[model samples]
Target: MSATEEAMNRRIVLARRPEGEPGVEDFRLEAGPVPEPGPGEMLCRTLYLSVDPYMRGRMNAGPSYAPSVGLGDVMVGGSVSRVLASRLEGYVPGDLVAGFNGWQDYALSDGTRIRRVDPELAPPPAFLGALGMTGLTAYVGLFDIADPQPGETVAVAAAAGAVGSMVVQLATLRGCRVVAIAGSPAKCGYLREVLGADVALDYHDPNFPETLEAACPQGIDVYFENVGGAVFEAVLPLLNIGARVPVCGQIAHYNDSGNPLPGPDSLPRLMMWVLGRRLRMQGFIVGDHLDRLPDFVREMGGWLREGRIRHYEDIVDGLENAPAAFIDMLRGGNLGKRLIRVVPEDAAGA
Candidate 1:
């Protein structure tokens, strides 16, 4: 972290807007002088970088809930970092924190939107996963939006993923029968054997629709939607009256080329079912619910301590590999929360 030890900063910047699915060519890695912390700012060396599904939306050039990453700018993301120098109050050199550091080896923060990470609560990398925004996203989406009742059958798409995994566990803890859906048998096994889901279904099965229907004989009372193409098509008809759906992400459609949907138009039928079922569907961005972070941290922290909640991370090493790892993650290649390890946990000044 010393200026004598490191002279340049390495970062990945958006090279171009992706046409459909992003490629490594869309990003460019560059080196520049490491930034200095000015008044009230802290110099942080990146430890871990989170790669998430929502980032796909940010790579586009269209309207979205958040601002798109402009060409030539650092790709937007959250990171776990170690403060190397501090002019900011309450923080000092060698303090680990979680904040927005983008895809870089180092960054400067004015202490805005940064939180102290207690290594005693969990590992530093965990701040980018279970005990961080990923966990908070699941907490807000399930307890605040979906609000599954005891005994209600809750169907979760991508149930083995970072957010979906959290949803499955939280819903199960709420006393709901969880029908966890994943693309692979191994993931489904994790959902069933490890996460305690009532039922687990693999979406790749040819009879997936029928299997899903059979899994929820009473009909799905709550659907935590993460993947939205055929998965939504199958879940729509099975939704019971007054069902609640918290739309978290549509990873299935994130790579669409803006072409028309391949199957027969189902909009009319979807609308009819929506009216007849009185279903409530809400799409939420977790950043808007930051007020709930303290409650989430406290409750989820207890669950982690009691072994009631488990978190898994698929970590890729090096800042240079972030682009490739991100591309692969979009293709359902990651099992849990995917992260890029920028620095070793036991490194000097860490």
Candidate 2:
């Protein structure tokens, strides 16, 4: 059932493309009649909407790996929703699904983009976090790219984030020594204590480079690059020969205005280091790794059921607060996977 009896649909639209860090003013809240399902389509009520760093790039006017969210459009995102009215086979009212439902309260889908959610072992939000795309991302970036071996030294940045935290744990389970780098002392502590990272360093530390080097005395064999700014620079010299670097994201410069990197005479130096260190650095888009989704679901789902994997949601209450929550997440304000709860989950579980 829909959250309310009112026949209104509330949504946050992208009012403007941000110049630097996005502000609440960049998004506008508007309401209209609840949409009806067309032939072969279903109407879904959003339960939880994800606020990810990748959405920031889609807000820019220029082209990226994905198309930008046009002005006045419901912002692009992934959401866990419930089917309200269905005209399609294999779908019915009260069915939970995960889909590209954007930021709106209710959306219509043609059954092409929606996947039925199985909340038997975990909650619906897990379809958006660890047991979902986020977990798949960590699986692809680590095993497919870095190929961690037992006793190898793995260093991951943004270690407390949804993806990075998964990488930390996955690598640990593979018998690798994990070194985590996060923006704050708290995140560093979370990585060390909760995620079982061998050592966690604060990127804010002035002697971060020295401390990171000390943590991995055997040299970093796999460097999972997520927050790639100064953290990238600090980890460069510590790479062992034939090291693997999987560049998944660069959230550090996601909020920076203009060209993400300036004065790039450093490229020559980076090339020199790559040559000297025999490094293998490759950037990947998770979309390209979708083939591995089934593999991720099987392994990660088992881990979740067994309570071997830990997942967290730093949920912001209400649909109206989505924009503020998004802005705060890009600024390192979120503790775990940041999400906006549009409608509260059912007590019986969705």
For residues 208-258, what per-residue lDDT tens digits would candidate 2 score against the true structure?
A: 988988898899999999888899999999999999999989997887777
Best by lDDT: 1
Return the TM-score for each candidate structure. Answer: 0.96, 0.96
lDDT of 1 by residue, 1-350 (tens): 56625667899999998888899999999999888889999999998999999888888887778999999999999999999888999899989999998999889999999999999988887888899898998999999998889999999998888899999999999999999999899999989999999999999999999999998999999999989999999999999999999988999988887753544567777878889999999989899999999999999889988999988999999999999999998887888799999878777364
Error of 2 at 170 (Å): 0.4
Question: Which residue pairs come into collision in candidate 1?
Answer: none
